[model samples]
Target: MADDKSKRDFRDRDRVSADEDYEVEYFAAKAGVTPQQVKELIAKHGNQRETLEREAKALRGNG
Candidate 1:
C-alpha cells in the first residue's frame, strides 16, 4: 500500500533544500517515489526530517 511507510527509508526525509528541480528529483529518488510525489509530500508534511518521520511512522501505524 502507498501508506505503508516501513517499506521506505524515512532517513531520506532529512535532505532539506528549497523546491528546486534537482532537490525535488533527489528527494523523489530517495523516497522511491516520483518528483510530483516528493513535492506533494513536502507540501503535505512540511520539509522537516522530524516532521516527515513522525508523519511517516504514523502513516505506517495506520496502515
Candidate 2:
C-alpha cells in the first residue's frame, strides 16, 4: 500500500508572495499601506514579512 498523506511545512509563511495579488493586498491592509507600496517594498526588500512590515511602518512615518 502507498501512503496518502498531505504535508504542511509552512516554511514560507513568514515570507510574502509578491506574485500573489491576494497576499499583496492582505499585507497592504495589515501594514496600513497601499498595494503599490507593498509591491515596491517587496522589490526593494526581498519579501521578508517582518522587514516589509517595518518598511511599511517607516513609509507611513509610524516607525
Candidate 3:
C-alpha cells in the first residue's frame, strides 16, 4: 500500500515538531510566546510538549 502523505495521524500530538511551522505557531500561541521563542525553546529544551510549555510559560512570566 502507498503511504498517505496528506494524512495527519496526530500520533505525535504530545510532542512538538520544531521543523513544522504550524506546530510551532500553535504551540507559541497557546504558550503565550513568540514563534521564534518557541523555536528557541525547542532548541534549548528539546521537542517534548510539556517541557516546552513549562519553559514557554516561564518566558512569559506565567510559570
Candidate 4:
C-alpha cells in the first residue's frame, strides 16, 4: 500500500513538472477555478497546450 501511494505521488509530481511551462496556476486563477480542477480537465480532454489554453479562455469568458 505504501509503495502504491509512493508511486502515485511520484506520478503526480511528474505531471506537475510536465505542466511547469503551462502557467496552470495563473490560468486557473483567471478562469476562477482551482489548479487541480484545471489539471483534471487537461488530463481528461487531452494534454495539449492549445486545448488547455482554449479551455482556460472559455472558462475565463474570453472565448
State each candidate's clash count. 0, 0, 0, 0
lDDT of candidate model 2 versus the reference: 0.87
Worst 10 residues of 4 by lDDT: 9-18
lDDT ranking from best candidate downward: 2, 3, 1, 4
Per-residue C-alpha lDDT of model 4 across residues 1-63, encoded as one tens digit per residue: 122433454334322322553556755775676788688767776656556667667666743
Give the poorly placed runs of model 4, Cα more than 4 Å off.
Answer: 1-18, 47-63
What TM-score should be assigned to candidate 1? 0.51
What is the alpha-carbon lDDT for the whole of candidate 1?
0.60
Over 1-63, each residue of candidate 2 has an lDDT whose tens digit, in order, gives 322225546687799888888789999999999999999999999899999988999999953
Please give the CA lDDT of all the candidate structures: 0.60, 0.87, 0.85, 0.58
Q: Rank the candidates by TM-score, best first.
A: 2, 3, 1, 4
What TM-score does candidate 4 get on C-alpha atoms? 0.44
- Among all windows of ten consecutive residues in candidate 1, which has the lowest summed lDDT? 1-10
TM-score of each: 0.51, 0.81, 0.80, 0.44
- The digit string of per-residue lDDT tens for model 1 on 22-43 reads 7667655655566775566678
Q: What residue pairs clash in candidate 3, if any at all?
A: none
Residue 43 shift from truth in candidate 1, angstroms: 0.9
Show model 3 residue runs off by greater than 4 Å.
1-10
